[model samples]
Target chain A: MNIDSIQNGVVIDHIKAGKSMEIYNLLQLYNLDCPVALITNAHSGKMGAKDIIKIDSENLDIDLDVIGLIDPNATVNIIRHGQLVEKKALTLPLELRDVLKCKNPRCITSVEQDLSHVFRLTDKQSGTYRCLYCEAKAERRN
Target chain B: MRSLIDILELSTQEIDELIATANDIIEHPEAYREKCRYKKLATLFFEPSTRTRLSFEAAMYELGGQVLGFSEAQSSSAAKGESVADTVRTVSCYADIIAMRHPKEGAPLVASMAASVPVINAGDGGHNHPTQTLTDLLTITREKGRLNNLSVGFCGDLKFGRTVHSLITALSRYEGIKIVLISPDELKLPSYVKKDVLKKKGITYVQTRDLEAVMPELDILYMTRVQKERFFNEEDYLRLKDMYILTPDKLHNAKSDLSIMHPLPRVNEIHTSIDADPRACYFRQALCGKYIRMALILKLLEIE
Candidate 1:
């Protein structure tokens, strides 16, 4: 498959196999006006089959924390002046605000209309995030 | 402003200080009588808890502080669809510090975020009750003379009992503390608590359905009522409920110094026959609640 490379944009590389769509949706790249290329099951030496997303826009601001939580191994390459300006790696964030909703029905955030659903990383090894209020473990959308 | 939302927010040193302060208050009640003469405490009980509410009121009264606010949601602006943040913000203007109890979990947290003054959680659903934990710590300290180097057994409703969870979390901070969990298999301690709190902290603990079997090894016995609502069937509830009742017989092999503690308004889980027992500290625990709360109020108000 042949796809045009972006002149000035971000290339999200080394995503785990079949996870590009979830990342793309969570990142809200689908709503973007600029051209976006999602390449899945691409052969790679490091990852047997990896998914990659190339955003063809320089002005787009991406939330690296979202990417970090989704796939810590993924690398983000910044493009400026049609050249790779910076390659960034992401790690799990200590606290996440409004990213995931607390599924606990008894949680105060569930009733409080204006309250933010906050979660803190409890276990990094298991990728566990628990609700700040009720301590209900966050169920990953995946 | 500082708030008392979770027991973990207070360190072991701070807890020790609070315990010391509570002991001082207990010893010299006259010394703290006029400590908060000009300060006011707002008891925002969105849920009806007459016991905890009166505890706060008595604490404030003993500290020479006036107390205000509603005892139930119907009596407060929360019934008018007022947000916790708004209510707390309004209450902060009328009072020096706020003690809030709401039906929803983390309501006190939201109040803390919004209030200008300190907000203490009286009880927030099945979430946290820091003052209750403080009271328990005070009770245990005064009873056993130390917080560490003892085997503490918790009986009944480990799964949904907020007090048990909070107390476990508080006791986990102490050294040489072993937790023996006693509850029916249906209402056994949650694995997440064991895994997250016990195993993560490297604290020694054991689980069993039989309470009498381990009664001899306990220095302090913390008991919580196992509500029938927790069980799906009447048969399971009937069969398991009586197994945890603390009767004279249950204390047969137990240590004479075992501090039998319970959060009050307890039903048949504790037989009235055992009220005369020297180890029955649940009623005394309620008294300790006021002293510790007075200490907490003084700490929050920065009063002498």
Candidate 2:
């Protein structure tokens, strides 16, 4: 299957297999008017099998840090005139506000609907984030 | 300027100073009677509490400060669907300081973030209870005469006991503290607590199923209630509830100087006969709660 490559857009590559849809949802690519392609279980030499999201839009601004939270190993490439202009890597956000929800039922954020869910990165290797309120570990939703 | 959200937030020096202040207050009650005379304390309890609320009220009254606020969420604006932020903001205008207890884990934290005045977390769900930690520290210092180099046996519900968790975290800051976790297999201390607080600090600790086996080596035996509310399985609660009962027979092997402590409202964990024992310091521990809370009130209000 040949998905058309855009002249100017962002190509999110090297996503772990089967995680392209989550990245797409998090990036809210569905809300954008531009064409978006999610290639799942694509053949990759670096990662055994990878997922890729190609957003065909110029001058589109997305939070790379949030993308990092979704899939840190993924690479973001800016394509200008169908040529790679800039390549960026994702890193774990030290603190995330409203991106991750605290799963602890006893947490104040759960009871108080208006409060923003804040999670702070505790373990970098495990990619663990703890709730700012109750200190309960935020479970990554699959 | 920060609020006391957790017992872990207090430094060893601060804890020592608070203990000193509590001792001073206990010795000279008249000296601190009017220290917070004009200051008002708002006890915004969004949950029903008998001991903690009374302790805070008694502490403030003894310090010549006035107390106000509701007993439960039904009486407070919280029942009217008000946010913790808005409630604390409004209470901040009425009172000089706030001592709040909520059913939610971080409700006081939200209040602390919103209130301009100092906010004290009395108790929040199954989360941190810093005042109780203060009370425990004060009782330990007064009973054992030192906070360092002691073997503390925490028995009964270690899993869901917020007091046990907070006290263990606080004790990790002290020197030469060894924790003996005694409980049935079902109510063992949570793994996050073991990893984050104990192992990370390299604090020496041992987990055991037998309380009597470790009784002789303990300088402080802290007992916690196994609450039915904390258990998801009723059968598990019933089976594990009566596992460790500290009676006169159990105390035969215990150290003579061992201070038996408990965060009260206990249920059959300790026999009534054990109350007469000199080792029983749980009552004194409760009284110390008032004095330490008095010290804490003074410290938070910045009153000399």
User: In TM-score terms, which candidate is top?
Assistant: 2
Model 2, residue B246: C-alpha shift (Å)? 0.4
**Model 1 C-alpha lDDT per residue in residues B1-304, reported as the tens digit of each score:** 5899999999999999999999998899999889999889999998888989999999999999999999999999888999999998898889999999987898998889889999999988888989999999999999989999989999988887889999999999889999999988878888988988999899999999888999999999989987664455789778877677788987889898888999977888889998899999999999999999999999888876
Query: For model 2, how does the per-residue alpha-carbon lDDT over B1-304 read when each residue is reduced to its tens digit?
Result: 5688898778888988999999998889989888888889999888888999999999999999999999999998888899999999999999999999998998988999999999999999899899999999999999989988999999999999999999999998888999999988878999999998999999999999988888899999999999887777899898989988888998889889999999999989999999999989999999999999998998988887
Residue A20 shift from truth in candidate 1, angstroms = 2.3
In candidate 2, which residue pairs clash?
none
DockQ each candidate and list the results: 0.76, 0.88
Docking class of 1: medium
Q: What is the iRMSD in Å for candidate 1? A: 0.9
Worst 10 residues of 1 chain A by lDDT: A61-70
